[model samples]
Target: MTLHRLILREIRHRKVNFALSVLGAAVAVAAVLSTVGALRAYDRETEAVIDEMEEATKAEMAKLEDEIRKSMKGLGFNLFIFPEGQDLSEVYAEGFASRTMPEEYVTKLAESGVVTVNHLLPSLTKKLEWPEQKRTVILIGVRGEVPIAHRSPKAPLIDPVEPGHLVMGYELHRSLGLKKGDTVTFMEREFTIDDTYEARGSKDDITLWMNLGECQEMLDMKGEINAIQALECNCATVDRLGEIRAELGEILPNTQIIETQSTALARAEARNQAAATSRAQIEAKEEQRARLRAEREKLAGWLLPVATLVSMIWIGLLAFINVRERLPEIGILRAIGVKGRTILGAFLGRAVLAGVVGGVIGVVVAKVVKLPSVDSGPIIESGEWIAAIVTAPLLAALAAWLPSLAAAQRDPAEVLRHD
Candidate 1:
């Protein structure tokens, strides 16, 4: 009889053992393929979520920037000019003395015809003592709208201040034991508080604001202003700022013109940096997740190879026992002129057939079974299935090699004598 027919007959007769061997190999393949599928799927999903969040964050930032740009309408032309002797950095020093500039400079700027001057607001500041309150007060004088006022949740738009009225900073109002309609004595003159503003979260928060004429009279510095904040008719741009600076240089050589864009850019850069930090944090989280998945997959990856080794061992053990039980049959076949190679092929062929069967079942189980750890359904790739199917039989063949050789080399004379 042919070796193929012989292997089929042997498998049919020992169906239970063959099925067990196939089942063992199938379980191993299923485990490996399933874990691989789940890990790949999870990685894809995590990247997708990260990408979506990044896009959403960018959109939100753009919307905020657009809103800020829109709200800044008709308000981007501020040019702060300070006297030459008083540097900008000196204003931040604890005991720095400030020098005032001539009030006639405002007239010179308007008269220079360099640019259209919309509003020329001159300001003065002085460090004063409120002896009754036992506190140092920052007294500010403004000829036009308050430069530091901004709309916030706690503070809304302020009404234009009348000449005699005083507006206290939000924190300053809280610190001073005074309120609207309360009388306060400064420089031997009594003045009533007209309004208390909300906290601006800056130096202005602790400052007191009043009319330019009142401050000039109180400080005894008439016709002398420390700084001038002007709103020009044209847009605030690099070119326009340069033109303004050149014009100011020609007219008021002792003053420095400061454009407001630097401060705006600083604020914008801070926000963008914050957004980038958040995005980095999110990406870090995703990367950590991916690393964990890889670790888990690495751990899980060992299971199938170990199972395959066990399956190979099991097949080897079965083949060995079969050879022992069928020694007389092998002896009879050899006696009847069957070649040793054919006998070896018969045993190895059986092992391969069992492996193929097991691999098929393993692929099916991996594709169907749902894992608790994996959120998505069973994921079995075609390549993984093919690898499992191909590797199983090869492993079985390798396992059966020694046993099959032993069977084929058995002396027919000794076996038939025992039979």
Candidate 2:
């Protein structure tokens, strides 16, 4: 007989058995699809959290650094006070004091085109005499680079202060109940509020700003500054700062130079530690997700086999009935000289066909139950879709094959004698 004729005859004779096996395979395929879907969802959730935290952390650090720079400048501006011989409460317009170098010293330094030997003044602690508290708030002196804000146009009260105007820390403003354009007395000198701005660090919160000259005069410390900060100029500027330090030491040397590199290094190390911790947390999270995924895969390994095993038992029972019912026909065919192996082949073929049909149906069922697309980031990366499709059908085929083989080997002559 032709292969088509054989196939038709085989399926027609065993239609019931074929139908049952198809049902079993279809169910097996559906189970496999569900397992793969769960894993993908977890993958996406972990990645999204990591990205947001990284961005926020960096922004916070930058904000802190910027705030520190502003506090320094504000302190520097406040240090603008009067000369040593000059009296306090005389100089006003918030400015710096220059040290009195001899005329020839200035001339020679100017000739070097490097050392500009002008009179550099020192600033002292500003004192805020609070009458109610009966205690003076000793204002900490900051270096140059303070952030100042002004009043808003509509409000003229809450605007961001511009440079050259003094701004107070937010808390300091609150404590004194001071607003924009209010004057606060410190070091016996009356400095205008000019404007009020929010605080960035500890110093700005408690300190008042004025010209360094005014600060020197008010504090009664003149022609000297606490520290000389360097601008990143050539080697000459660096060298000059060092030389000027010695000259100033001879003149009135009691100040110290703070090495910014150490501070910067410490800051960078802190940032590195933070980043490392973040990375560690992320790794731990990812590892946890990986562990969960591994568990899921293990569960799938058990479930696929278990589902196929249970499904195959049903198929085996169906195969047994089909074999029993057709035994008389099978015995007659054998007596009429048909081959035994051929009978076995025919039965096996029918089961295989049924299993394939069941697998296809199961796959169709899975396709019908589409997972709703989640908009969560990174949840559905590439390659996962490929895994889902390939695993489903193979599992279904296995479910049907093992049971049908057992049924195919039954003795037809013995079965024919059954009632």
Candidate 3:
């Protein structure tokens, strides 16, 4: 028989092995595709979260700057005096009042007539906005100390009129639905929201405000205030917190210096750094996981095609072995004049027929059940498709080559001796 006929005969006879190898190649291709798909999905989600954080950061920084501007009015000094005609000597002696700043400074202000202290109640506009939240809007108290008067009504954009009146920010006023001269409640007490003045670039414009005396009574914080934002002579003057703490200790010994900026900023920066580090670590772990997952998927992919290749090779092996076993038959043919190349050709033909049938079956099966391409990564490249298809066959041919070559190497004389 012709060498081609001999190869075709063996392939047609061993249909089962031919079928298995074709299936194996299809599985490997699918696994490769699935891994590429998963990476694409992960990239999109992380991008959105970063954008939200950026906006929030800018808003918070603006709040800090406003607090600094407000605090600058105090110039690190203020003098508190008794009410008009109240006789400071008696008030000082009777223990009803005590000076928090330097006693000398109060004397200087009183002598110069530049510093004056007065007590009055007034309502403040809301500084924060929350829809349907009129009740949540609150009036924060301000002091009528030197810092308060030194406050640039023109610069901050707050309109502080006579006793019992304060300004509101446009943003705050619009939210609370209150108008100038309107009334609002504080601790169930009432005051007029008068003379709304614009505080440039501050959300505090919404705050309807009154003097410290009103805040102390309304908030029920008599002799106790939540915070003090005294103006420093210079932003440079309050460089070190320890110095501020020491100077504040000497000036306002009993009052606590609560921080809205320096201390808070230090802690915030530390936390931001830590969060960045954690995100990087998480990203590292994710990258490692992606690699591992890809490997497992590739392995899973090989199972079917590899099994198919092994089965087909085994089928081809059995046929070749049987032919080797029929040495007397093979020897007679050789003796009659069949060439060694023809004998080798016969075994190779079996592998080719099986490979083609299996490849075609694999290709058809892969096509029918073809999974849609999954999006993977921020950028999926075009090379992946070409690589997967091209590699599958090369692997299959290699798998088929070894066993077929082994079948061809047997000595014809030895095979005939067995007969």
lDDT for model 1, on a 0 to 1 scale? 0.72
- Residue-pair clashes per candidate, as listed? 0, 42, 28
After superposition on all C-alphas, the RMSD of every candidate to the true structure, in Å, is 9.3, 9.5, 12.5
Per-residue lDDT of candidate 2, residues 78-150 (tens digit): 1222234532232222222233212222222223433322222223444466454355454433333211112
Candidate 1 per-residue lDDT, tens place, 1-419, comes to 68899999988998887787787678777777777776776776677778877888788777755554433322333467788877667754632228889877776775565553344566787777866567777887866643322212221123345567788877867877678988776556777898876666755666778888778877789888887766443343456556666767787898877765443444356557767887887888788888888787777778757767887788888888888878988999999999899889989998899889988998888888777766676566777889889988888788888999998998999999988
TM-score result, candidate 1: 0.56
* CA error at residue 46 for candidate 2, angstroms: 4.9
Descending-TM-score candidate ranking:
1, 2, 3
> Per-residue lDDT tens digits of candidate 3, residues 1-419?
56676555655665554455444455444444444444444334334434444445455545644554444332222222222233446433532222222223322332332221211112222223333344444455555433233433324322344446655556666766777888755444565776565545553544455775565555454554333333332223234444544554454444443333453344345446555665665566566656755765676477545654565455445555555554565666566667666665665555444445544454444334423332333232346555555655555555555554554555667766766
Assess candidate 2 and give its TM-score to the true structure. Answer: 0.56
lDDT (CA) for every model shown?
Answer: 0.72, 0.50, 0.46
Query: Top model by lDDT, which number?
Result: 1
Tell me the TM-score of each prediction against the true structure: 0.56, 0.56, 0.40
Tell me the deviation in Å of residue 237 in model 3.
Answer: 14
**Model 1 misplaced regions, further than 4 Å:** 63-262, 377-381
